[model samples]
Target: MYRAHSTVATPSWFSIIAALVAVMLWSAAPLLAALAHTSSPLQLTALTLLAGALATLPLSRSVPMARLSKGWQASVWLGIPLLIFGAVSSYFVGMRLAPAAEAALITYTWPVVFVLLSQWSRLRTLRLSGVIGALIAFSGAALLLLPQALNDGLGGAANGYALALLAACCWALYSWLGQTAPVALTPLLPRLLLVACAIAAAASLLVEGSPKALSSEALLAGIALGLGPYGIAMVAWDKALRLGQASIVGSLAYGVPILAAALLVVAGMSVLDWRLPCAAILVVVGCCSAGRRDG
Candidate 1:
């Protein structure tokens, strides 16, 4: 049976901190998209993962070689590397093809996907509120995609939207598998990240050849993404999940699109679109409603 077990009692403060970390992690989307303008998506993914792997080397060292080897072994058996590669690659591709804000909003549907998958797998049960909330949130997602569909008819931004949805599904599966895997993720994360980096690098080489020299802005942004969102943020998220209820953590994910949008606007990467606010409101409300305790 797939069950989530927290090593420590969850505190409201800790949950709040975890939620904030999640927001920060996702807020990197627009910045990453902006960097994609100067670098290929595959190259950017490779560089970011490589940076994250290097940053986490110290932690990896603390884990015994035997355990690390087991982690690598588990990654292959469990297909973690492929899952991470697909999710990250698709996300970057989608961001490159569409507005960062739209991609973020679409990918943020992972929580809902996670909940639904858990229920379908019999790992968890959803309350009536959860069902209602899922419907509402999904409706909001449709609203966000509807404009693109109407404008381009599956020829333009629709591809990006499809990729974003694929990314979301992949992410949901990854999270679920991580929770249920026999191997502990703390020891496995570094190995999995390194593997993902290798995959990204190979894909980049195949698709883009040797990367061209990047602009100063692109270089700095890539480094920041590696150290911040792809690196420390991941560590923080894992810690939080280990210490908190997965449900609460998942619920808090509704804040991601909002944070991502705000960050994009502040960075001057996106303009305020009326649809965004409306979609944000609907999604937030639906997700929050789904989280309500019925008992």
Candidate 2:
């Protein structure tokens, strides 16, 4: 009995903890960018991906470059499109319509998609508690994002919200693909993927006529976003997933939004009225309690 329990609990706990740390760091990306006063979210995302991809170079020994497959070559190359559409486009377009909190709520809905995919794939069964938890989380999300929905003129905000949610769906696809694909490419894959993404982004900037519009500050912020949050946080996320199952990791990923919110409050970017705290608490409870029935 001791052995049985230990085997299961240990991996779950470890994955959860690792994911918690990863998300916390990952959550800081936007706040730091906001604090840095970045001019363009698209450019920042490009730089972030570039930095993240570059960081993997030194860690090449962990995922040796030689072991990668021909198919993986395509997969590695394909990440450019994902980064551009998912990270760059989503960041710029989503931020325009939705504030960070609203965008994050929609984006983080990947967990629900994850859950549904797991059930559909027969990877795992979903519990009623998890479903209820999702609804509760959604409720908190609505409160967090739609406070002025009626009066604020949903025009672009609604579009942004939809785009962000779509981006989250893309993220779910990314996660799902990971389960099937072994992390066979070296650490270089991520960095290389970023380079690919950068190329794509460069093409985008040229086409969009953003070069003249790009300021020195925006460039720096882009580098920071690429290197710090995009690059470093991804390493953290990779470590977390390397430790164990997706479910536990996804659960712990909930910590990101909370941390982001706290940072927003500290920066005075958002209000900490009674509803905010209450909503945050409810979100925490719902997410943390989703699986506690078995615990």
Instruction: Point to the candidate with the largest TM-score.
Output: 1
- TM-score of each prediction: 0.84, 0.75
Off by over 4 Å in 1: 1-15, 61-78, 123-130, 151-154, 242-251, 289-294
The parts of candidate 2 lying over 4 Å away from their true place are: 1-21, 36-38, 61-76, 79-84, 123-127, 182-188, 199-203, 213-216, 240-252, 282-295
In model 2, which range of ten residues has the least summed lDDT?
A: 1-10
- Per-residue lDDT over 1-295 for candidate 2, one digit per residue giving the tens place of the 0 to 100 score: 0000111233556666656656766676656656544455555555556666775555554554357787765665575346435745575567666666556555655555544564457635766766776677668767766667766767767887888777666666655555545564335546555665667567568765564355676666666666656556566556656666545564566666677677777877666676665566566666554534443
**Backbone clashes in model 1, listed as residue pairs:** none
- Candidates in order have lDDT scores of 0.71, 0.59
Which tens-of-lDDT digit does each residue in 63-171 have in candidate 1? 4436446655665434776777787778878887777787777777676676677666763566777788788877887887777678766566777878888988888
Q: Output the TM-score of candidate 2.
A: 0.75
Highest lDDT, which number? 1
